[model samples]
Target: MTRKRINVGLIGLGTVGGGVARLLLEQQRRLSDYLGAELTLARAADRDPALAQGLDLPAGVLVADGAAVVADPQVDIVVELIGGLEPARAFVLAAIAGGKHVATANKALLAHHGREIFLAARQKGVGVAFEASVGGGIPLIRSLREGLAANDISHCLGILNGTCNFILSKMTAEGAAYADVLAQAQQEGYAEADPTFDVAGTDTAHKLAIIAALVTGRQPELNDISTEGITKIAPLDIQLAGEFGFKVKLLAVLRKVGQAVELRVHPTLVPLGHPMASVDGPFNALFVEGDWVGEVLLYGRGAGRRPTASAVVGDVLDLARDVLCGCPGRVPPLGSAAEPEGPLALAPLDQTVCKYYFRFAAQDKPGVLAAISAVLAEHRISIEAVIQKGREEAGPVPIVMLTHEANEAAVQRALARINALPFIAEDTMFIRVAG
Candidate 1:
């Protein structure tokens, strides 16, 4: 019996691209046997051809022009690892136009231009596999699309960015400051030099936008999310949280509130016993809640060359099996045209209501707590717990308070009034408490 050969064309010979080539070449026999087809790395294109030197490939297997690889007649699938909107979008559209399948790990590209790209693939009747886009090798997107298809997912909470998680976890465990841990993470290769995107929650929002579309049938813009970074978190806050039996984590949270969806990213305080709180270091964990499936948690290494490549290879095999069976677009694109409700509205952050952890730095004098309590009461923001650690008589003391469920608008108003007090020394720091 003979097996069909699915020729794969790759763009961007970066870390992930090299891993994909290595895996496809080394695991050819196993993958071919599993898919009932021979998978071939027919060609690859990278801007710097020198990057392909280490990957042992046949002569002329790598080219400088990505479009050439996409336009090749022998290529059946285009694996796009060049992570950006311009050329990657063009390359994916070109592949679909040439009637070829695509697999990509570029979450930013998909988050920004997915509607246009998926629509093109649909019109061309080709499959677009993006299993590597979110949660690295955790198979999160597949779980939402297939495994948990029967249930309507109501809420999704995840520690999406490994860099942010690593920083926060180290701060909690070792009682280190955010800056110190971030510096350590950079030295250890967990964080980049700039580290703005991961620390500022933009990277997590991109992944959240993708997951939100998969679950809610609507894609959200980056501006729609109320994003807060870990830069504002202080070591004193972490200590206060530990005292109250809570842990701090940068969380991406999405909840379906009636017809409107609430999307936000911030440093969240989860109960010490919760699974997300225990997911420390540079690991990712997504907690999805559904009507039928109940609660499901997918946890694993969210990023790295090998783990991300594993996801990309999984997508390759998926596309290969589809090509062999003569079924493209077998699974409808996420947020397809057939969704009856169309786009869902994002609930304004002002309307969001949740418990909160508030830290106020003020003079270690009388009437400070009373004045703060009076303002909170005026705004109807009741306090759940309060802890004030001892401080030297020369400096202001830190007062940490956990509040009951309250509207964000009220919290802001109350905080404003509290900040205006004469004894207050610095701006108040607050973190939302996850339910």
Candidate 2:
């Protein structure tokens, strides 16, 4: 019995690309047995060919030109681990045009130019599988595309950024400041030096945009997904949240609201009992609610070399099998045909209604609480609980409150009015309480 052979081309020799190469070489026999076809790492493209990746490749397999790898007649599939949107996008577009299947771990590229790429692949009649783009090795994208294909996904809540989760987990456990925890994360290599993309919720939003498109059948504009960072999450807020039986986590959320979709990323206060609250430290968790499946939780290492590489290789095998079986493009790029209509109408942030936790710095004087309550009353916002810490004679005192479900627009208006009060010492801090 002879097995069909499929050649693989990889771009980028960075951490993820190195892992993919190592896996392809080390597991060639195992993968061949599983796919019933020989999967060969025929060629790879990296800017620095002499970078010493510590992997043994056959002679002449390494190339300095990405376009050459894509244009290689022997390369059947292109696995792109070179992140970011620029040349990676160009390489993917070129591969699709040349009739090569693509497997990428770049969430940002897909988030920004998914429709264009998917449309090109569909028209070219080649498949684009991106299992590593979202939850690393959790297989969430494939689950949504195939496993839960029959159900209607209504809500998706995820702690998608490992850097932010690590910071939050350490902050909660040690009662440390955000800056201190972030510094520790950077020192531990859990966060980058700048760390803006991971901590600012941009990374989570990128993955969320992809997930929302898969679940809701409508791709949302990047700007429409309201994004907020964790820089403002203070240790005091984390302490107060514990008192209210909640934990602070940077969350990416998407839910269908009638004809609109509510997409946003921010620091959220999740109840202690919820699984998302328990997802701690450099780990990722996604909770999706389906009409028929109830609630599903997929958790794993969201990023890193080996885990992410495993996902990339899984996609390679998938495409390899499709090519071997002469069934390429049987599975659509993002689970279905790209919607003919435009982007989904994003539910305005101001119109959102949810429970909230608020922290206010106020003068340690009489009538301060009354003044704040009066403004909330004007907006019809009612308090569910209050925690007023000991007052300081000269320094402003902290007053915390948990509000019942209220309109986001009303809350913003109420906050503005309260901030204007003479007794209020500083701008108020608030986090939406996840339901």
How well does each candidate superpose onto the true structure, as a TM-score? Answer: 0.98, 0.98
List the candidate 1 regions with Cα displacement exceeding 4 Å: 335-337, 340-342
Which residue runs does candidate 2 get wrong by more than 4 Å? Answer: none
Candidate 1 lDDT at 278 equals 91
Best by TM-score: 2
Q: How does model 1 fare in lDDT?
A: 0.90
- lDDT (Cα atoms) of all candidates against the true structure: 0.90, 0.91
Total clashing pairs in model 1: 0
- Kindly give the number of clashing pairs for every candidate: 0, 0
lDDT of 1 by residue, 173-209 (tens): 8999999999999999999999998999999998998
Best by lDDT: 2
Query: Model 2: which residue pairs collide?
Result: none
